[model samples]
Target: MDIANQAALVTGGASGLGAATARRLAAAGANVAILDRDAAQAKRMAGEIDGLAYACDVADAASAEQAVAQAAAAQGPARILVNCAGIGPAARIVGREGPMPLADFEAVIRINLIGTFNLLRLAAAAMIATEPQGPDGERGVIINTASVAAYEGQIGQAAYAASKGGIVALTIQAARELAARGVRVMTIAPGIMATPMLLGLPEQVQQSLGDSVPFPKRLGHPQEYADLVVSILTNPLLNGETIRLDGALRMPPR
Candidate 1:
């Protein structure tokens, strides 16, 4: 699917990975729409990229539905949907504070896992209805963001890891189900990327984290993730797979 001029939707596009992706897609000639909870930031990014912006809470069915509909109204139905909006506050299931609040765990699951599914289902339905493109009759592509923590969750990442794990598990199943509709589903499980949250740490701490990577010895760039998204969109054969953009880093259980 040559996404040039095609409608694309990116959640959490205000900053970090999603912002990078929006810029990359726009640069590649895609008509991009950014959906985020931060209305002001979303507006700012949209203005920068000349794309549409919608205030959306990805976890809410009504909010996501309204935002997707509005985006389609402005830019046509989205043929490219990327789920990048998520949270990752670390907490132990049982700690000195006693078992982590059930609400905390539920919140992560809601915002990360269920939120991803909300947008995915809406976007996939819209994609399925759109006229297929290219010789393969491809209708659309969806790329989701997960984390290496899903595979090797550390001591205090129970909620965050479980949320990402759900996304990882959903990848193949979604791909298999959407394949017949000419929709491809894939996932990127990043490791220690230089996202804003990570970059906010002290310099020495950041350096130490980067040094843990097996090679390159640096944090993954958000642009790299965007590049992979472009690769997945253009390649016809890649589907039902989760690619780790971790530079060969298999995390230890901290």
Candidate 2:
């Protein structure tokens, strides 16, 4: 669909990939809304992009619903929903600390997998309400963020990998279910990127990570991910797919 003057909602839009995507959408003429748990940062990013800012917990049902409602009221129903709110804390399921805390496992699943679904369901329903636009009877498009860990998880990333795996697993089913409603669902499984989390590591570690990529031999940029999102939104044929944003790097077991 054309992003020009369209309503777009991006979760976790305060920083990293989400922030980059919000900026890109705004630049492409979409009226964007940034929904994030980090209220101050969300507002700051919104101000920078001249988009709406909403303090929302994507894992919370009521919070996501309220934020979507507010954004719709301001910009009309959001036809572009980007599910980017997630956390990645590394821990083995059974470590020296003994089996991981059940709560820790649950937390990752809650914030990453369930969070994506929450927004998908809510936003797709709203998209259904809007009249179909564009040639393919497209109501909207939903882009979810996953990770390369989902496919080749290292030793300390059991929970993180599981959460992301669920996201990748959801793509085809979600797209099929939402297809009749004119809402397309797709996912991006990104490799190591220069997100805030990775940027905080020591330079040597960062260089090592970057060098691990096969060809580019560098970390992926958030803007590159945003560019893919734009392509997915505009290309009517892309749906029910999980495109890997990795530089042909299949990770090794840690």
What's the number of clashes in each of the models?
0, 0
What's the lDDT for candidate 2? 0.95
Model 2 misplaced regions, further than 4 Å: none
- Give TM-scores for every candidate, taking all chains together and pairing residue i with residue i: 0.99, 0.99
The lDDT values for all models are 0.95, 0.95
lDDT of 1 by residue, 99-204 (tens): 9999999999999999999999999999999999999999999999999998999999999999999999999999999999999999999999888999999999
Summarize candidate 2's per-residue lDDT along 76-170 as a digit string, tens digits: 99999999999998888799989999999999999999999999999999999989987789999999999999999999898899999999999
For candidate 2, which ten residues in a row score worst on lDDT? 128-137
Can you give the lDDT of residue 169 in candidate 2? Answer: 91
RMSD of 1: 0.6
